[model samples]
Target chain A: MSLIPSHERPDGDPLRPIQRFCEVVTYCATLGIYAYGVDGPKVCLALPYCEDILGDADRQWINTGAITTLIDSACGSAILHALPQYEAIATLDLRVDYLRPAPAGGEMRCWAWCHRITSNVAFAQSEVYVEGIDEPVATSSASFMRLKPQKREAG
Target chain B: MIEPGHLKAEAALPPPEQFCRRIPHLQHLGMRYLPACVENHSAPVFILGFQDRLVGNTHLPALHGGAVASFMENSALLHLLMEQNGTSRLPKLIDFNIDYLRSAGPRDSFACCEVAKLGSRVVLVHIRCWQRHFDRPAALARAHYLWEPVSGNTELAEDIRP
Candidate 1:
């Protein structure tokens, strides 16, 4: 069974299906991540704070893993937005620098952009910001291995 | 629940299983603490059981990169905490760098951490993760944490103490 829904493509835009596909991802959905939209070449996503996602219960800080997940999802979506057509990609490496702790009880916004796309790899960077904070709480760089399309079986 | 003065009162650190159970995120991911006997190493090991919600790529049927990273990071943190006896405050994560050596298949993943360096105010940890075999690792990570000394009569400490 196909994971993506079969329907009319809206505005002949290639990104709509990709966006929809990202929204339904089991991991992303479980984390409460939602794609805000695409701005220029950047894709924006949001992760709302929840008790289940907290790393430090006493301090009320979001888990670094959750933040990493948000950034990874945003970076992956940015690659999809950059590509002319949808192609599978896997993360080869990801480095996250936590400038400051992300306080809980507020939504965190992430912006990612595919800085470069080589023949076999795609590089992306992302920054995460909490609402009302001017400085970014965390920043990340990631490289994804672009996979070749699979061959279809003859009818 | 762990008391605020628990670390200070005891000479030895709490067990990994007891400490990890308090972390809501680890609980959410369904991570279980495994004894050191599971691996040949002396360090404690952690297992992340496979579940549909943890899958990032439905096509490849692989675990999410973030989930794997999370497991490694948590392992490192727990290792540091377990080894660092009498540390009142939790270490702050300064940075985490991970290399995905292979795609983590949709199965139970394992992780173990080693302390590369232990300094006065900084600690560095190396983490390795594998699914099927320890020799063939799925990913490796290096994490830096800021270790703060416990200060007496500080409002921050008073506030954080439960």
Candidate 2:
């Protein structure tokens, strides 16, 4: 039924695979907040657009969903950008700290960077902030794992 | 095995079920505790009801990461109560970490869990919150609650402490 032999595996990991993974996770993450009408990775961390979701002064301190969205998007982007170097990339772990709640009715912006890539894992960090403040509303760090396709030997 | 800090009726502490009622939404979400209890000091910790409104990307607008964390932490109180039959215990949050894979749509989130370990002085719980009907979770958090034993009178005094 199969085309190739089980022992002869496929060559490398898929291209832009992280993007596909993000798309799936993005869809699943918003299941709880469907009433808000926010969807997709495109809606995440887009500066001015973030304000639309985080409206109001009193509501700002309690809105953390925006931060969650931003972190997911940033991490996705980081992994996708590194897709070419698949073997060198992986998410080891991620941690997020919410210092204070974001302002209500304003979307939060996130920017994450892959700070270090090790033999088997990658370390990444990101920050979510409101429109005005330099101080981040939330900060997160993530670890990713990398795997390489084995090269076939000449028989 | 019960921890030394486990609340016994002699401790005269509020029941975890009562505390679960304190949050009407938690009840609406159908969160239940295997064994619920209350702490003489520290934030109340318990477990989630049976169903969480938000799961997958269905309820995108309403759920907040902070709210999810609060739900997980608050539920730990119930777990404590059930463990001790409403006895006084010291509550301590060791650590909680959440991975935001995507934004949850606006829906009630559900969560369930058990105490991974309860030691002579420390209780570790692995708690998870998910929206109803969704395979993936809105968030996952694990909290370690520390219970310290004290005289019944001392427990009451601690509860009254500002």
What is the TM-score of each predicted model, taking all chains together? 0.83, 0.44
Among the numbered candidates, top lDDT falls to 1
Candidate 2, chain A: TM-score against the reference: 0.55
Q: Candidates' DockQ values?
A: 0.62, 0.07
lDDT of 1 by residue, A1-155 (tens): 11222133345454475457566677888887876655678877888889878887667788888898888888998988898878888888999999999988889988899999887889999999998789999999999988874444354
Over all chains combined, what TM-score does candidate 1 have? Answer: 0.83
RMSD of 2: 13.5
lDDT of 1 by residue, B1-162 (tens): 111121111122224554554467877777765544432447666677789999987877898888889888887877776775525566789999999999999887777788887766678899999887777889999999987657673543434333
Error of 2 at B137 (Å): 15
Per-candidate local distance difference test: 0.77, 0.46
**CA shift at A93, candidate 2, in angstroms?**
2.6
Clash-forming residue pairs, model 1? none
**Candidate 2 residue lDDT tens string, A1-155:** 22222124344423234334344443323322111111222112333343323212222342243345456456545654544443333233456666655655444566566666555565667777776677887777776655453344354
lDDT of 2 by residue, B1-162 (tens): 222234232333323444433333333334443222344322332333222333222223434344465566556646565556555543444444655444445544444457777665567777666554335766666665555555455554444333
